[model samples]
Target: MKNLNEPTQENVEFMIEEIKVKLRMATAAAMQASSFTVERYEDIKDLYEVVASKEKFSISEVEALVSELGQLRK
Candidate 1:
């Protein structure tokens, strides 16, 4: 994205929500568990990294989603 180190509060908030939407969309596409391969894993990893980079404390929230995503694909 925009090199989000020390990003503005508004930008960080927007990004957090944006990442959530992206994850949701990806999850929808992968609900059958067929798309749970390397590409989807990388996308989730990138989403977590983007959120974690801006707000360390929020990593757990994303982690939960990531974990659920994995389980759903299994």
Candidate 2:
């Protein structure tokens, strides 16, 4: 497994993919990892951790999370 604690492009991509899967996002095709940058690595990691720690999410929660992600995007 990749050491996600490291803030590298690969790690950011991995986390973004994992987040998409975990959220079961319908519009995931629009949320490409390439849209993000290493500068927002910490924020992305925090979002990843939140998604990872949860098995399911409410509709509102998912909306809020996606909104935050949109804000963090390049």
Q: Could you tell me the lDDT of residue 74 within candidate 1?
A: 30
Off by over 4 Å in 1: 25-47, 50-63, 66-74
Q: Using alpha carbons, what is the TM-score of model 2?
A: 0.95
TM-score of each: 0.31, 0.95
Q: Which ten residues in a row have the lowest lDDT in candidate 2?
A: 1-10
Local distance difference test values of all predictions, in order: 0.49, 0.93
- RMSD from true fold, candidate 1: 12.5
Across residues 1-74, which tens digit of lDDT does each residue of candidate 1 receive? 65445434444444444555555544543344333443344454455465555543344665676675555243
**Model 2 alpha-carbon drift over 4 Å, by segment:** none
Candidate 1 local Cα displacement, residue 62, angstroms: 7.6
Tens digits of lDDT, candidate 2, 14-63: 99999999989999999998999999999999999999999999999999
Candidate 2 has an lDDT of: 0.93
Indicate the worst ten consecutive residues by lDDT in candidate 1. Answer: 30-39
